[model samples]
Target: MQIYNFSKDNGKKIGIFNSNFIMSRIIETNKGAHIGCMYLEENGIIGYHQATIPQLLLILDGEGYVCDEKKEYFKVRSGDSIFWEKNEWHETKTETGLTAIVIESEELNPSLYMPKKHWDVSSVSF
Candidate 1:
């Protein structure tokens, strides 16, 4: 598992038509890619399972915790992007709920687009 960031801090300023907004590019897909939105209600959980394909979860709103194969949970929030390799075990849970975009494909390579978060995995908990 790898965590990347797409927060406003990493966005590019959009000056088109004098607009003062920033846009963060999320991902570009190849053929046969599947993309969808995932809505987890309060106290929700996406039970741990092996990824069917390379997956990228882009948190669009709220916050949550993600667990890897080691059973260690890490805090995640809006603008955070989590990637898992095919057959990798992972789970997601939130006490308050969250909305995210999930992209699955066999050709996913997020590192080429977003910068990886320098997180301290040693600080992870259950």
Candidate 2:
């Protein structure tokens, strides 16, 4: 077991165009389980991306928009959480910045649970 301090961990650049978003990887898989917290600046956006491992997102602060390609956008704020399966394409747009904790693990791991077809990506396969 390990403890992570988001404020002290330091944030790193994650996006292509804008470098305002910062991500601090709190925990990572040594035995195939991954957990982390990401902090974003106001008006920052994390471009669309997909994960090979399944993930669950727990919103910790601020407000934002979460969306996939096919479905309508959803608003996310503090105390909200969502799950995304492997290969699902998603992105976040924050108007007031946001902080979220992410938990993910290998697909074969029974301890990890993921949503089914959370997004409508065509080519990607998990």
Candidate 3:
């Protein structure tokens, strides 16, 4: 097991995240899993884009808005958890700023090792 303290280390700048924000990577496992903390200052935004892997977002502080491709949006506050599947289009903005922890995969198709089903559960299939 590995441990990290984001507050002790200065975070690296990445991608098209709002210039005023910071995304600090805490750990990147050999399995391609990534854990990071993000700080978005008031009015900071993460623009619309489709993800290539499954992701779980954990909001740690403050409040914000998260949106889908349809342009519909929802408010999220601290302690909220949001999940987005591969290729899901989404965006985030903090009108009053917020901090969140992002957990995702580095590889485009990392394995979560789900168990194979013995019985088919599809409603449309026989």
- The CA lDDT of each predicted structure is 0.91, 0.60, 0.61
lDDT of 2 by residue, 21-108 (tens): 7674433455566678999888887778885677666678887877765544676666555556788878777878999877787643
TM-score of candidate 1 against the unseen true structure: 0.90
Pairwise TM-score winner, candidates 1 and 3: 1
Models 1 onward score TM values of: 0.90, 0.58, 0.59
Stretches of candidate 1 exceeding 4 Å from the true structure:
16-20, 120-122
Candidate number of the best lDDT = 1
By TM-score rank, best first, the candidates go 1, 3, 2
Identify the superior model by lDDT, candidate 1 or candidate 2.
Answer: 1
lDDT for 92 (candidate 1): 97
What are the per-residue Cα lDDT tens digits for candidate 3 across 13-124?
5557446555544333556677789999999888888977767666678878776666566666764556667888888888899999888875422123211112223111
lDDT tens digits, residue span 9-111, model 1: 9889999998999887777766589889999999999999999999999999999999899988899999999999999999999999999999998888888
Choose the strongest candidate by TM-score.
Answer: 1
Candidate 3 wrongly placed segments (more than 4 Å): 1-31, 106-126
Model 2 weakest 10-residue run by lDDT:
110-119
Clashing pairs in 3: none
